[model samples]
Target chain A: MELLKERIRAEGSVLPGNILKVGSFLNQQMDIALYNEMGKEFARRFSGTKISRIVTIEASGIGLACITAQYFNVPVVFAKKHRSANVSGDLLSATITSYTHQTEYTVILPKAYVRPGDSVLVIDDFLANGCALEGLVSMIVSGGATVAGAGIAIEKGFQGGGDRLRARGVRVESLAIVEALEGPEGIVFRK
Target chain B: MELLKERIRAEGSVLPGNILKVGSFLNQQMDIALYNEMGKEFARRFSGTKISRIVTIEASGIGLACITAQYFNVPVVFAKKHRSANVSGDLLSATITSYTHQTEYTVILPKAYVRPGDSVLVIDDFLANGCALEGLVSMIVSGGATVAGAGIAIEKGFQGGGDRLRARGVRVESLAIVEALEGPEGIVFRK
Candidate 1:
C-alpha cells in the first residue's frame, strides 16, 4: 500500500475536476510487478474470507482481478460494458452512470458464473461517485451472491465513493486513496 | 494446453454461426489457474524472443495479457477501447473489426509506455480474422517498436487469421488451433 501511494505521488498527474491520471502504471500501460504486489496485498487483507468468485467491471478492473485471482484460487467474472456476441446466458445486468464520461452504461455478468450464496470480491482500478461499485453490487445481489467486500488499486477519496460504500457497511480497501492534489504539490493520502 | 482444450470441450458452447463459446473460462468468467498454465505455455513457445513488453487490447485481452506478463517478467500495456477523461496522453490508436460483435472499434495505447524499438509480445484471448492483432501490430509499428511475434490462446484455424499471419512470415504460436468443431463430436486440429 505504501508502495502504491508513493508511486502514485511520483507519477500521478492531477487534472482539473479531480481526475487523477495513473496511465503510466495503474492504467493504459500497467506495471505487472505492482499489480502482483497489489494482488498480494488484497490477498493479505482478505485472507480466509472464503472468496468463491472475483467480480469486476470490464476494461481497467480486469487486470487487477485476474492477477489477484491467483491468490484467491477463484475464477474472475468481469461485467461486460458492451454486449458481445459471446455473452449469451442468463445475465445479471445493471445500469450505472459515469461522471467522467457523462454517460450511462449497463454492466452485465453471466448468471451461470455467480450463483446463490457465492462469496464474491468486487475489484476495480478507480472508484468515483460509487456508480460502478453500485452496479457490481447490484449484479451480485441479483445473482443471490454475498458481497465479501471490495478491493481497489487507487481511489479518489475526495469523490466520496469509498465513504459511501463504507457507510453502507461494505469493507472497501484501496491501496492508494487520494485525499487532495495540486499542481506539483502532488497527491495527499488519508493517514 | 490440454487443460484448456478439455475445458473448451466440456464447457464451451457451440453457438450458431460457428461461434465456440469458452466464456466460462477464457474470457467472461476467467479461470486463473488455467490462465497461469496458458501463460506458461506462451512463455515456453516464445522462449527465445527477447520480449520487452506485452501488449494487448482491453476488456478481455487485459486479463490474459496481465497473467501472461508474469511469465515474461515484463509490464503489460493494454490498449483502451473506450475514451475517457483519464486518457489524455498522446496515443497510438488503430481500428479493429470485432469478428464476434460484427462491429468496429478503435483501440488506444498511451505513447509514453511502449518505447521505440522495444520488443513487444502481442497477446489476446482469441484469434479469428486477426483484426485485433493487426490493429495492435499497427499501433506497435507506429510506435517504432518491433513485435516479437504473437502468443495466442486459441486460433480458429477454420478462419483465415492465423494462417494469413503465418503466411506473411510472422511468428505466431497458438496453443490450441481448432481446424473444425462439429458440435460436441470434438474439435479437429491441423496437423
Candidate 2:
C-alpha cells in the first residue's frame, strides 16, 4: 500500500472536478509489478475470508481482479458493461451510474457463474461514487451469492463511497486512498 | 496448450452462427490457473524476443495482457475503446470493426505510453477477423513502436485472420487454433 501511495503521489495529477489521474500507471498504462504487489496485499488482508470467486466490472477492474485472483487462487468474473452478441443465457444484472462518464450503464454476469451461497470478493480499480461496487454487489446478491468483501486499487476517500460500504459492514480495502484533491491545492492522502 | 484445448472441448459450446463459447474459462469467468499456464506458454514461445511492453485492447484482452506481462517483465498498456474523462492528452487512435458485435469502435492509447522504437508484443483473448489486432498494430506503428509479434489465446483459423497476419511476416503464436466450427457439426482444431 505504501508503494502504491508513493507511486500515486509521484505520478498522479490533479485535474478539474476533483479528479485524480493515475492513468499513467494504475488504469490505462498498467504496472504489472505493482498489480502483483497489490494482489499480495489484498490476499494478506482478505486471508481466511473464504473467497470463492473475484467479481469486478469490466474495462479497468479486469486487470486488478485478474492479477489479484492469482493470490486468492480463484476465478474472476467480470460483469460486462455492454451486452454483446456473444453473451447469451439468463444473466444477473444491475444498472449503475458512472460519475466519470456521466451516464448510466447496466453491468451483467451470467447466472451460471455465481451460484447460491458462493462467497465472492468484489474488486475494482477506483471506488468513487461506489456505483460500480453497488452494482456488482447487487448482482452477487441477486444470484444468491455471499459478498465476502471488496478490494480496491484506489479509492477517492473524500467521495464517501468507501465509508458508506464500511458502514454497511462490507470489508473494503484500498491500496491508495485520496483524501482530497482540488486544482493546484494539490492532493492529500487519507492517513 | 493441451489444457486449454481440453477446457474448450469440455466447456466450450458451439452456438448458432459458428460461435464457440469458452467464457467459462477464457473470458467472462476466467480461470487464473489456466491463464498462468497460458502466460508461461506465451513466454516460452516468444522467448528472447525484444519485448519492452505488452499492448492489448481493453475488456477481454486486459487479463491476458496483464498476466503475460509478468513473464515479459514489462508493463501492459491497453487501448481504450471509449473516450473517458480519465483519458487525456493526444492519443494514437484507430477504428476497428467488431465481427461479433457488428459495430465499429475506435481504440485509443496515450502518446506517452508506447515510445518510438519500443518493441511491443500484442496480446488478446480471441483472434477472429483480427480487426482488434490490426487496430492495435496500427496504433503501435503510429506511435513509432515496433511490433515484436502477437500472442493470441485462441484464433479462428477458418476466418483467415491468423494466416493473413502470418503471410505478412508477423510472428503470430496462438495457443489454440480452431480450424472450423459449424452448428451441430462440432469444432475442429488445426494441428
Candidate 3:
C-alpha cells in the first residue's frame, strides 16, 4: 500500500469535485508492475477466504481483477454494462448509477457463472459512491453466491463507500484510501 | 494453441449469424489459467520484439493485455471506447466497426501513453473483420509508435481478417484459428 500511495502522490492529480486522476498508471493507462503488487496485496489480504471466483465490472476493473485473479488461481467474471448479443441465457442484473459518467446502467452476469454456494470476491479499480460494488454484490447475491469480500485498488474514503460496506457487514479491502482531497490542498491518505 | 483449440471445441458455441461464443473461458467468464498460457505463448511468439508497451481496446481486451503484459514486463495502455471526464489531454482517435455488436465506436488513447518511437504489441480477445485491430494500429501509427505485432485469442479464419492483415505484412499470432463453423456442422479448426 505504501508503494501505491507513493505512486499516487508522484503521478496522481487532484481535480474538481474531489476527483483523483491516476490515469497515468491506474485507470486509462495501466502499470502492470503496480497491478502485480496490488494483486499480491489483495491475495494476501483475502488469504484463506475460500474465494471461488473474482467478479468485476467492465473497462477499468477488468485489468485489476484479471491480474489479481492469477494469485487466487481462479477465473474472473466481469459484468457487462450493456446487454450484448453474445451475452445470452438467464442473467442476474442490478442497476448502478455512475457518478463519473453521470448515467445509470444495468450490470449483468450470466446465472451459470455464479451458482448456489459459490464464493465470489468482487474487485474494481475505484470505489467512490460504491454503486458499482453494490451492483456486483447484488448480482452475486441474486445468483445465490456468497460474497467473500471486495478488493479495490483505490477508495475515496471521503465518499464513505468503503465504510458503508463495512458497516453493513461486508468485508472490503482497498490498497489505497484517500481520506480527503481538494484541488489545491492535494490528497490525504487514511493512515 | 492446442489447448486453446480444445477449449474452443469443448466450450465454444455457435450462435445465429455465424457467431462463435467462447464466453465460458475467453470473454465473459475468463479462465486465468488458460490466459496465463496464452500470455506465455504470446510472449514466446514475440519474444525478441522491442515492445515498450501493450495496446488494447477497452472491456474484453484489457484482461488479456494486462495478463500478457506481465510476461513482457511492460505497461498496458487500453483505448477508451467513450470519452470520459477522467480521460483528459490530447488523444489519438480511430473509428471501428464492431461486427458482433453491429455498431461503430471511436477508440481513443492519450498521446502521452503511446509516444513516438515506442514499440507496441496489440492484444485482443478476438479478431473477426480486423476493424478493431486496424483502428488500434491507426491510432498507434498516429501517435508515431511502431506496431510490433498482434496477438489474438481466437481468429475467425473464414472471415478473412487474419489473411488480410497478413497480406499487409502484419505479424499476427492467433492462439486458435476457427477455419469454419456452422449451426449443425459444429466448428472446425485450421490444421
Give a tens-digit lDDT track for model 2, residues A38-59.
Answer: 9999999998889999999888
**Order of models, best lDDT first:** 3, 2, 1
Please give me the total number of clashing residue pairs in predicted model 3: 0
Taking all chains together, the TM-score of candidate 1 against the true structure is: 0.97
For model 2, residues B72-147, the per-residue Cα lDDT tens digits are 9999999999888878898999999998888899989998999998999999999999888988888999999999
Q: List DockQ for all candidates.
A: 0.85, 0.88, 0.86
My TM-score estimates for the predictions, one after another, are 0.97, 0.98, 0.98
* Steric overlap count per candidate: 0, 0, 0
Candidate lDDT values, in order: 0.88, 0.91, 0.92
The 10-residue segment of model 2 chain A with minimum total lDDT is A180-189
How high is the lDDT of residue B139 in model 3?
92
Error of 3 at A147 (Å): 0.6
* Clash pairs for candidate 3: none
Model 2, runs deviating above 4 Å:
A183-185, B183-185
> What is candidate 2's DockQ?
0.88
* Worst 10 contiguous positions by lDDT, candidate 3 chain A: A179-188
All models, RMSD in angstroms: 1.5, 1.1, 1.1
lDDT for position B170 in model 3? 83
